[model samples]
Target chain A: MNALAARRRHPAAIAILLLLGLVAVGGAYSLLAPKQAQASVVSAGDINTGKSLFLANCATCHGMNAQGSAAGPTLVGVGAASVDFQVGTGRMPLAAPNVQAQRQDTSQFTQEQIANMAAWVASLAPGPAIPGAQYTSGQNADVAQGGEIFRINCAQCHNYAGSGGALSRGKYAPSLTGSSGKTIYEAMLTGPQSMPVFSDSNISAQNKNNIIAYLKTTQTEQQVGGMTLGNLGPVSEGMFIWIFGLGLMLGCAFWLGQKAA
Target chain B: MTDLDTTGQPSTDVVHLDEGHHIGTGGLPARFEDPGLPTHIHRMADDSPDAGRRAERQVVALFGLSMLATLVFIVAYFAIDKSVGIFLPGIGSTNALNVVLGVTMGISLFGIGAGAVHWAKTLMPDTEVVEERHPQASDAATRSAAVGIILGGGEQAQLGRRPMIKYALGGALGLFALPFVVQVAGSLGNPTKALAGLRSNLWDIAPGVSPIRLMRDPEMTPIKASDVTIGSVFHVMPETLKDSQHVLEDKGKAAVILMRLDPNQFSAAAGGQRAQAWGYQGIIAYSKICTHVGCPVGLYEQQTHHLLCPCHQSTYDATNNMEVIFGPAKRALPQLKITVDDAGYLVAPEGFHEPVGPSFWER
Candidate 1:
């Protein structure tokens, strides 16, 4: 090591080495810089457009300050992620309010309009924002590792395959099969509805990516059995076993008895 | 065997014979006729030598395949990585190791069954025999003979004559059951101690000790009062549980859910004044275990101030001192009384006054 330090005295070599180091740093910055930009982009939108849209469409129920009214719950602290989820999914500008907001066929607002509304609401109190573009990038995600993470963090409420299950009262863990990579990440970050927030402090960004990968993989590849029987698990499996297996056995016994007689 | 006559009635035509022995006069029938069985047909494998050889080879091949599949299963079990994915026709992608192991094991089991069925059908004996059915009831003389044989057996053994042997056998049989009885009795160890442990969990603190600190579960970090937000909920465990060997057992009893609500919304329901005073500010801690079947009650509706148990639809109103507002839970979730120490960290001043988790019949 001492001999190597004494040998490296060439000016040309030093310059070349410096250039290579600069290029490496530049390459890394280019690779990583877009993610930071994308996060800022999530929080950037026209505040005036957002306010005008809210007053015209939402203020009647949510109130002018968006602190909730008798008709609607407070949206003050609920943030951009909640707005993106509620409005992006077309569950917000509810047609005729009901027990629970249902997913609609098409979102009434455009993507730009949704972004503006999210920015306005987010500016009010500063809560959990929608997951940045890096979360949904889906690069270097290990599907198998994701399966393990999903089983631990999600399977209790959502079914083992992200098929969703009933929770307490009228609530249910919605299926992740239809959820986009962004939606699933945002839901984990923001904890929409009664779901508990799995913050970055709890589940890291990389772990969240793994979970999204697992969800996407499950959407394509589910149970490989001849028939799934609705994938309700034990209830369907037990019913099929009792009815089909017993019926076949009983038929065989009857046939054998007839032959004997 | 009685032969069926043309009139479909049984006729006695065969004579009974006992070689080198005289027949006892027990009033049994003297003669009966043999009832013929159906004729047997030879299979192709049995008739033809070449067919028989082919059948033998097929059975051998099946057994060989079975051995090969078993070897494959064993090799796959060790060599294949569980995470490796394989795309199968009609099945889509699945764990390669599981698929290989299942297929090989299934083939191994199926080969044995198929080989046995084929061997039985082609090579095994196919003979029909007719056995005569007699009256189910025995004659009075036969019954008496059976009783006499039993009596003869007793006399030969001389059990009645040997009092010592009789008593020894009786004692051995009686003592044989003691081990099982002792095991059952030992399993039900001092019910009072078990009940006391259930009633007073790890949070019960014990006498002359400082108040137990409330730590974040899994993280085991002490939580400050300022850390808790209005709508936020924390899954907490006692600091004493951090180094305990029985973490799961202790955590099951000691797990508490800490939630903060508006002070104006707090209502004194069942516990009244005492329950209201136990809370620190609007922040209160209640047993995480549901009163109905003891599921962890984690789901909280911040808007309604309802603590929901996932196992059952038991909703506890945290604002009303964690009263069971809905579902099958008849009793309220027990509240943990908490206070801040000089360090400004949350601590359990005293243990839960009432038993935590599902209620017993004695309660």
Candidate 2:
């Protein structure tokens, strides 16, 4: 604190001290607490009716505790944000199990029902709740830094092309061409599917934003040479060369080497 | 008297064979033996006893030297280390084993050749050979005679009757042959243990801790909820590999991909239209570890919102549930459920919904 701060502190010392103490506590809370976007409130009407609707509709497939069973993945730690993203978009209430989960229409869950389901999921595990579908704060913190971070962390499996690849079994890691920074951050906040959670501890908010900037900047840039298959760097690119490109080259080389002169 | 057969000198030079002849005298061969043939030059050893004994001893010494060289080759083979060279400050490091073994093997083979040539030159009959022209096909009688001639040569060698000479020659030849077997097999016995090292990598991020929080690799930094903007993508991973023995140095092969999308755009589960609290506001994380052969799936396209695996152009739709959109990968990247910790940094709510790394289990 400067001289002015000291003077300000001395004047209504008790209240100022109390205020300072509160700010300190807030800082600590902010560190641990999810600094959620201060979006508009969920209407009283939706939440009030959503409670009972949730009990009746969702208790069967998902456990009453909201812990997943044979029919579904556990929803204990998943937040309303995920619920809104999944249900509001109609990816939930899947028609059937398959290689990839598909998005469908949202008429099945009424607004109140959707709210209640989100609340019920929250009851099991309190996480980032989804506001309607509106998103702000798409601006990233940095661009050049993000590129460095991406190269070190994401280049291995995701490839330089942003093309996804296979993992053990049928699981795969997807690309991030047009995804909003909010979704990217939330996904980090809440690991959905097979993606692990990259907590703020792992990658600071500034670093995450930097990564976002890198992704956005590169999207529209004109690629120098046209073809970039997988871009998973060596593993994928090498395979293409070995299987098709190199094979063709080798064939030509063999012809030249054995030209019967 | 000496337990040895004494040879009778062909030349009766008991008194004097003058300066005109001191052994190795030449004479024409019988006409029936070689018609119009050159003279048969007689050597001093054929007619003199002392000179022949001297030549025999010289051949034995050559064999003895060969046996000594073979012994040294075995010593060198067993002593050299086939270990990788480490950097040293001043005197450069080279493959010591290669140099030592190469020199020893070279010496071993060279000595044998030199000794054999010496034996032929100084001990064995050095006279030029001339074979009579005959039909290619041999009669049984001639075959038997050839076998008899070989047997007679073996007797002449006295490999068995001369115990000292036989043992010395055999020892030399036997030692020469043994190092070859040792040379090839000596450096090949440690593979079973080495193979296991390549199989199971040190990527386990610890145990008991579910959903090891994904952290930015290398720097070990944390991600914040407020930082990510809409229409942006971030590649992320767990903070600490406490649940497993995850090492940062190995992240080049094990990182994951992350992106955020509009909630409305994201597909809901069959459970409802409302999205699960999977994202803070709409952020999602996916394994960068490719589902197809485990390549790191990256190079995300912000416009198309596609995750592309550089390996085979496999794309994953982030708007959907990370389903494979294109290319060879069969499944979506495993997702790690996450939530904010007390410090507001994103942390794994639980471990990955599915295992991480490659499709190691066809099972």
TM-scores for all candidates: the values are 0.68, 0.34
Put down candidate 1 lDDT per residue, A1-261, tens digits, no spaces: 599978878756878999999999999998877431112234367888999999999999999989899998889988888888888777788777665676664577777888899889988998878778787755679888778767645676777888777755566777776777888877777766666666665556887888888878766663444345555689878998899989866865564343110
Worst 10 residues of 1 chain B by lDDT: B1-10
lDDT of 2 by residue, B33-149 (tens): 323556656565656777677766765665666677667767866775566442323323445555555556666665566556545544456455878898888899999999999
Fnat of candidate 1 is 0.04
Candidate 2 lDDT, A68-160, residue by residue in tens = 779776777677767755665455666677654444533356555666777767766667755322222436356777777767655544545
lDDT (Cα) of model 2: 0.60
Q: Which consecutive 10 residues in model 2 chain B have the weakest lDDT in total?
A: B1-10
Model 1 per-residue lDDT at B347: 93
Worst 10 residues of 1 chain A by lDDT: A34-43
Evaluate chain B of model 2: give its TM-score.
0.43
**Candidate 1: where is the Cα deviation over 4 Å?**
A1-43, A64-67, A103-111, A133-156, A159-162, A177-185, A188-191, A196-233, A239-261, B1-83, B88-92, B100-132, B136-153, B268-276
**Candidate 2 wrong stretches, greater than 4 Å:** A1-45, A52-59, A88-90, A99-116, A129-140, A227-261, B1-216, B220-363
Total backbone collisions, model 1: 1
Best by lDDT: 1
